[model samples]
Target: MRFLLVEDNAELADAVVQRLGLDGHAVDHAGTLAAAEDCLAVAEYDLILLDVMLPDGDGRDFLSRHRDHLETPVIVLTARSQISDRVGALDQGADDYITKPFDFSELEARCRAVLRRRGGAAKNEITLGEAVFDPMAGTLRHGAQVLDLRNRELRLLEVFARAQGQILSKGQLLDRLFSMDADVTENAIEVYVGRLRKKLDGVGVRIETVRGLGYRMDT
Candidate 1:
């Protein structure tokens, strides 16, 4: 998942970013409301961890104004623990609220719960074609049959699956496949694609490559 963390506290932002990364998410940090608005205008995020006490303005106001247009889920993180505060945030369009000094585990669970709801699942699973992907466990299933995929293949399939029918460039695929510190070249993506394709064979969906463009799944 991709998350935009809007926090003014430098230390807290760094810690949250690291924790979210370890939990297999790509996070973008914005310390001020202006910066966050700029990020939102340009990039799409799966979730937003919005801090009410932003440097430039109150995050609640931002949510109230922008929530209608933003399909992404927002979880308000704040120091306030009052019942009114939680109710107010929800009224202003927050999906979930977490008080400060919270257990990271609980935050992670909240994230999964919110995302599960967003994906329209009773549990934490996403379906595409015949594949039912469990993002939490990183597993894919087709009814009773499960495909045993390697780490790289799984990540690649994940990108394609989430993209739905959108065409993806090799550059986009590379970004999803390797972290900044990982030693990998763009050409190596094709190797992973080849392996993923073989495993996906006869799965009722196929990954189609557009000669000059990139790859996308077709049913």
Candidate 2:
């Protein structure tokens, strides 16, 4: 999944980014509301991790301003443990609130739970022909054998699964598969698509190219 992290603390930002990246998620870090807004304009995120206090303004204010526009789930990370603070953040549109000095495992769990709620399932499995795509496990399996999918490949599959039977333009897939700072080319998407095609060949799944439009995943 792709995430936007609004945080001013460099250390905490770095730790969050590194940990989430290891879990096969693309993260973009913004130190202020301005930077976060910039990121939001360019990409659609699966989730957002927002700090309550930012360099530019309060995260709750930012949340309130954009809540109507953004349906993406947000998890607020703040040092204020007061009940009012938590209630205020939630009322301002935060999906979950996690106080500082919290464990990364707990953060991970919260993210998963929020995403699950958004997707409407805990497993959120997608059937690809005879194969099954599991977002939580980050794998594609056919009966007993698990297909060897790299992180990007698996992420691409997840994106397609979520929007199954719909055409996805190259730009949309690019934003979902790569981070804002990733030094990747448009043709790189074709490379990954080609690889996925070969692996899924003869399986119930098909990646169809719609002439000049883009690609669609069909089952």
Candidate 3:
């Protein structure tokens, strides 16, 4: 997925862009409302992470401006956590709202929630054999027992569990595991895959490597 991040703060934009990029999404940064409008004019984006305060104009006004034509999901980011602010943003066509100083995990979860709604996916948990994986919550359950997993493991497993039957190449796995800021090599994926495979040992699942192709999860 490609995202347009409409933010004025350079630090926040860098952090969010790097995070989204690590999730294998292409992100474009626009520091002002005009830059955002210009990017929206020519390019297509799956999502927009918008800051309510901008140098040129209010982001909520921007939402109202493209209310009729913009079908992509917009999640508002604002320092103001007032009820009226949240209500106004939603009323103006924002898909979801996030307050400032939010947990990055929550932001990721909210993004998935909006995307799921857009794709008409009603279920939040995915089942692979006896193991149940919740991408939003970042949890895995095997029967009544819940497995503790690292952040990287959870991210990697989510990718496979979401696409249980499809094969993902090493390049794809690398994309899922690390981004531009992540100074990791292709071999890093092997280490994670090995660890994840062991973690799911008795969980009634296996990740198989296809020669000359990639990897697939068998449930």
Candidate 4:
């Protein structure tokens, strides 16, 4: 998963970025609403961890303004413990809300919960033929064996699995695998795809190249 963390607290932002990175998710930090807007203009994210009290403006107001066109889920992170604050965030289209000084584990669980709900995953595990993907644990299993996939390879597979059966262009894959801050090219996606294909060979899930268009996964 890719995330945009809109926060001004450097320490909290750094900690969130590191924790999510450890789970194989790419994250971009935006210390202010202006920076967050710039990041949003350049890339797409699976989720947004937004801090209410940004350096420049309120995050809830930002959410209110963009929620109409933004399909990505947003989880409001704030120090406000009032019921009105939580209600206001939800009314502004926040998918979830987390209080400040919360545990990293809890934040991770909330992220997974929001993603699962948004992705229509009722269960934590997604089974494709004999392969089972645990989005939370970032692991893939085939029958009795666990696949030793590289981080990029696993990320590619996760992207394909989430949007299964839909055609995804190389450009779309590139954005999902690498963050806007990362120095990567469109052709790098092909290299990762090739490697992932070799690993998923006979796993009952097929990655089909759609001629000049892109690729699609079929189970």
Candidate 5:
């Protein structure tokens, strides 16, 4: 999984990033809101570990600004242990809140639990005709053969699988796969979809293009 850590404390940030890396997650660190915004603009993170206080602004403000558009889960890490602080963060759509001087183990567990719950809510395996994608393992299987997929391809598959038969626009896919600040054009999504279509064809999975509407998985 990929993560973004937004914390200004140099030492604390280093420790958290190293610990999370040791846990097998690719982590990116940002020391300020601007830096964090830049990272968020280009990368699609699985989870965001946001510090309540930053050099420029409060994390809550950032969450308020982007919560509607970004679906990635967020966990607020703050020194404020007040009930109001916790309530405000949750009300702003944070998935969880952790107080400062927190146990690293507990933080790791919370991250895992939140991700597990999200995956559980959206089934790991999606079946469309003869094709099945095991998202947890990042594998695409068809009958006896297993197809190779790139990271972006797997992310694309997850989006389609989660949506099932629903029509998803190219814009929507880009938003989900890339950050809002990404400089990628809409055509980039089409390219990825085209590549995915070829792989799906090789395995007998039916991914249909709905003309101007975009793509869908036909079961």
Candidate 6:
């Protein structure tokens, strides 16, 4: 899953980012509200770990501004453990709350649970045209033939299947498949798409390129 960690403390932010990365999550760190806002404007995150107090503004205010516009689940992380603060954040549309100095395991568990609930079991199997992909097993089947897909191919297909018909740009796909620090080129995305296209042909699923826009799955 992809996550946005909004925290002002550089040390804590680094720790969180490293730990989350170890847990197989793509994490982006934002030290201020402005950076967080910029990240939100461009990319979609599976979950957000928001610190209540940011350098420029309160995280609650940020949530108020974008909660309704984005479907991403947010978990507020704050030192303020008051009942009122928790209630306010929740009422403002936070999916979960974590107090500061908490265990990273608990936070990780909450993040996974929230994403699972949001994604649901139906998302485990994606069907596009004659192709059926089982994410848990990392298997792609096109009728009677099974296509051999690499790890990156599976991840790419999963992202497109999750978005389905939605247009996803190369940048967005790179961020979803790799970390913020990955040294991926624009051509890398094209190469992956070309590879996926060949495997998808066996199943009669077509991944259409949208000129200068991006790529989309066509059933």
RMSD of each: 3.3, 1.6, 4.9, 1.8, 5.8, 4.2
Ranking by TM-score: 2, 4, 1, 6, 3, 5
Which candidate tops TM-score?
A: 2
Name model 5 segments beyond 4 Å from true. Answer: 1-5, 9-47, 56-72, 77-113, 119-123, 202-204
lDDT of each: 0.83, 0.90, 0.84, 0.90, 0.82, 0.83
Q: Estimate each model's TM-score.
A: 0.80, 0.93, 0.67, 0.91, 0.61, 0.69
* Poorest lDDT segment (10 consecutive residues) of candidate 6: 115-124
lDDT of 3 at 151: 73
Clashes of each: 0, 1, 0, 0, 0, 0
Error of 3 at 41 (Å): 14
**Of the candidates numbered 3 and 6, which has the greater TM-score value?**
6
lDDT of 5 by residue, 1-219 (tens): 577899999999889977775543557789999999998877788899999999999999999999999999999999998999999999998999999999999898788667767666544566756877776567888888888888778778877877878999987787677643347888988898988888888555667889989888866
- Candidate 3: which stretches are off by over 4 Å? 1-5, 11-48, 52-72, 79-93, 99-109
Model 3's number of clashes is 0
lDDT of 2 at 214: 86
Q: Model 1, residue 31: displacement in angstroms? A: 1.3
Name model 1 segments beyond 4 Å from true.
Answer: 127-131, 141-155, 171-195, 198-205
Candidate 1's residue-wise lDDT over 1-219, tens digit each? 668899999999989988877755767889999999988886777789999988789999999999888999999998999999999999999999999989999998999899889878797666767778777667889879888986557667767876878899887877665544457787887888888888878777788889988888865
What candidate 2 gets wrong by more than 4 Å, as runs, is: none
Please give, for residues 70-165, the per-residue lDDT of candidate 6 as tens digits: 799999998998999999999999999999998988887777567657887534577877878875456888778778987678878878887888
Worst 10 residues of 2 by lDDT: 119-128
**Candidate 3's residue-wise lDDT over 150-203, tens digit each?**
777887887787678899998887765553345778888889899999899998
Q: Write the per-residue lDDT of candidate 4 for residues 1-219, one digit (tens) a residue.
A: 789999999998999988888777899999999999999998989999999998799999999999999999999998999999999999999999999999999999999999989988787798876799886777889988998887768778888987889999998998887777789887898888888889888889899999998999999
lDDT of 6 at 146: 77
